[model samples]
Target: MSGHACGSLRHACAALAVLASIGAGTAAAQQISPAETLLFETEHLARVRVPATLVYAFRKESNVEPGFKDEVRLELAKVNGKLNATLHFLTGVHKQDIPALEEAHGNPVLLGFLEHDIAEMKRLTGGSTAYFRKRIRMALAEGAQVSLQPITYQGKTVQAQAVRIQPYLNDPMHARFEKYLRKTYTFILSEQVPGSLYQLHSSLGKPETVRTGTQPADAPVIDETLTLISVTPKQP
Candidate 1:
């Protein structure tokens, strides 16, 4: 459960600096091409069982920010086969991984702030929707603005934006709450290049040091068909 998702947050933050460097370097960008195959470097943090939540942090070759970079932490709650999830994404000036990196390297207060934030996340999502919604609703009601956007992914287009109210919000244990954060960000990609992949070169969890030449065992295995699923582009 903790295998992939748990480490995504850590890896996302670590890769941000490298990604920024690549973005600023023409050579790095040039080496990456639409015909050269695109890779998605991603890490997953946390997994959900019933009312489960999965979080992913990744960087893609194409997006509003090519070499687009950001960390999106998502929490999903499920019940009776219905699923609702919330997403919190940090971008540009509000990016969390980079700032967390700054703190992890030198700022103690930033580290503390991060720890506090994660703890709150865990607390809010630790139980079923019933156990968490009222608290979530109250939090959202506290003046947080909800924004929605249209996104196309997997050949299907849907509104991808921050949503409140999800799977476990109605659990008896969470009745004091009135809302929960539920959102999913969707990506629309077409013409994927083959052989490009985002892989972990090494993990302290394993004996390998971070190396660039070989594939990491934990890298995602994308079936060719799955990659082709639901991809469309607007006519120029």
Candidate 2:
């Protein structure tokens, strides 16, 4: 761990699940749905051979504050014939090991972005990440609506699965965090993409008005997106 990692990063990282190989599955024994399979059980990184580098574009828009932009870089390699990942988390020297194949094999873009958002939510609302993570996990397994949708990747259209969930809409803290009661998170994934995860869109209180591409007066406080830009392969 680095100096910057000793702070909030260490606390929020608990959201990233590192499971046992007992089945490389969840602790509960039950039938898994397509949404759970796509989000967790699928080997998203195996579609690409190591060594590789995945770059993602990160952007945040808010009605109350300045917009922010950055890029997340992930380096991929092979360790003991399994996909090993080293992520330059969001900023600073906070790097960590992500055994993409052995545990939580979902792409870092999905896990890391959500982890970052959950951390921010904690900072702003004083809520526990475990509460949010459980709601999301349960939503994927029990409440998510999965469907195939066409998305553009690298300037071409490809078939992707979109998993949409609203983890906090009916949250017990409804009266506490009233502003974000309408928060929603959407994930797009495809086998064609190297890491399988294409994009994650999250918005709170965004509403549709007329067809002129205008937001209502009560637009969301925060609108954020993390999308895969490209993947480059290197000599292993």
Candidate 3:
């Protein structure tokens, strides 16, 4: 073959290879699902830096309690690869001073409660450890759901995921409490930053009828909301 023809053929082959490479890359990107992408992003964020701090502001409102409002500040940090959180209640009926708590202990009050219950279950079912373990695993699996969504924060649209966790209360007393009580918690977490939370809102209370009338046999009397107003990253 002529040298010119050979050169042209080689160039064509090179172009085809480049196009094939591009096609493969596009296919791989398409194969990544949203959940997988989020997991990858969060995991990447987690490994980025240690001892990072996040700050948030909280607000609480209640319908039954007239003129009821609560303000607080929250700080979340990762220290030595462990998570720590502190809650500072500014003004509220259930106001109190809380010291820094480790994540294992569920730093936030509700999280602490969950951790406590799980620990109690482990202690109680020492003989049937596997059974209890399985129960807890199944409960978590059933209660947890995640979805990719967009949120507006600080005048910018950012990608986020809504994580809903509603573990089953096996304790008879706890079940009784939920029977007549209503509770909701919303946590706003960043998709790009692992362990970074923008907001958390919790609302729990009894119905108006229960509040006005005689208390039911087993009804939890509680009303409150906790919100995260802002998050500021702290230098290591």
Candidate 4:
């Protein structure tokens, strides 16, 4: 359990469940009923899937002259749901700013609570409204995406307001992403077994763009690949 804060990113991330709720109205009504409870279960699962560490590589290429490449690896953890522990490295360096990486880890209390929280999620999966809402609120308090200004749920239309983050994060080239950089998504959660609903969706996040060569100088296009990674119950 890494320590991190649940910020606009986590909030936005937590809101991803909204997409999973697409076909979930019926099951929720029959069992959960309360919106809070549904959200709680959703958040619990989300937390589990949060990557303890992430590694990404980016290389620079030239249209006319191609050869130089650079890659970066980032180790991430959560602190109250927001990204906390993050170690950034620029590949070639063996021991870069490792202290800063360790500093970015997470809070102990938050990690401890997650264990109990997940247990509660299992208990409340088919439980009551109060239990569900309590957990959901806890998750939301960490700051989840309230964007969309409001959306439709269980036949009722509701609006969700967006929270602001640094605008630079929204830029794909930067480290932090602002609220506006979020991808548009649609989700549908349906019960496969009598009491369980499997959620699925078409996530509309940024499409990856690959350019080779120096910037400001019409970088040559090398290759572009846009792949979709689907989420399964166990994987989530």
Q: Give the best candidate by TM-score.
A: 2
Expressed as tens digits, the lDDT of each residue in 106-155 for candidate 2 is 46666677777777787778877776676676666567889889999877
Q: What would the per-residue lDDT of candidate 3 be over residues 1-236, giving only the tens digit for each residue? A: 12222132222212122112322233233333342222222332343233433333434343433434545555556777665656565545445555565532222433322233334344533423333333333332334456666877666688877654433344233443343223443445664433444455444444564667665524543334443444445333
What is the descending TM-score order?
2, 3, 4, 1
- Selected candidate, larger lDDT, 1 vs 3: 3
Every candidate's lDDT:
0.27, 0.67, 0.40, 0.29
What lDDT score goes with residue 140 in model 4? 35
**Residue-wise lDDT of candidate 4 within 1-236, one digit each (tens)?**
00122231243223233222323242223332222232333333233343543332333222433433333333344556554444443345322333232222222212212222233333424444333333333333333343333434334444432322122222343222122123221212222111111221212122133222223244233221111122222232
Which tens-of-lDDT digit does each residue in 1-236 have in candidate 1? 12221132333223222222222333233332221111122211112232332233343331112233344443344545443434444456545432322101111111222233334345544643222223332222222333454544435555533222232333344443323222211122222211111111111121121134243555322110011111012111
- Which residue runs does candidate 2 get wrong by more than 4 Å? 1-30, 92-104, 206-220, 234-236
Q: Which run of 10 residues does model 3 get worst, by summed lDDT? A: 11-20
Query: Poorest 10 consecutive residues of model 1 by lDDT?
Result: 194-203
Off by over 4 Å in 4: 1-51, 79-82, 85-89, 92-219, 222-236
User: Global CA lDDT of candidate 1, please?
Assistant: 0.27
lDDT value, residue 7 of candidate 3: 32
lDDT of 3 at 228: 41
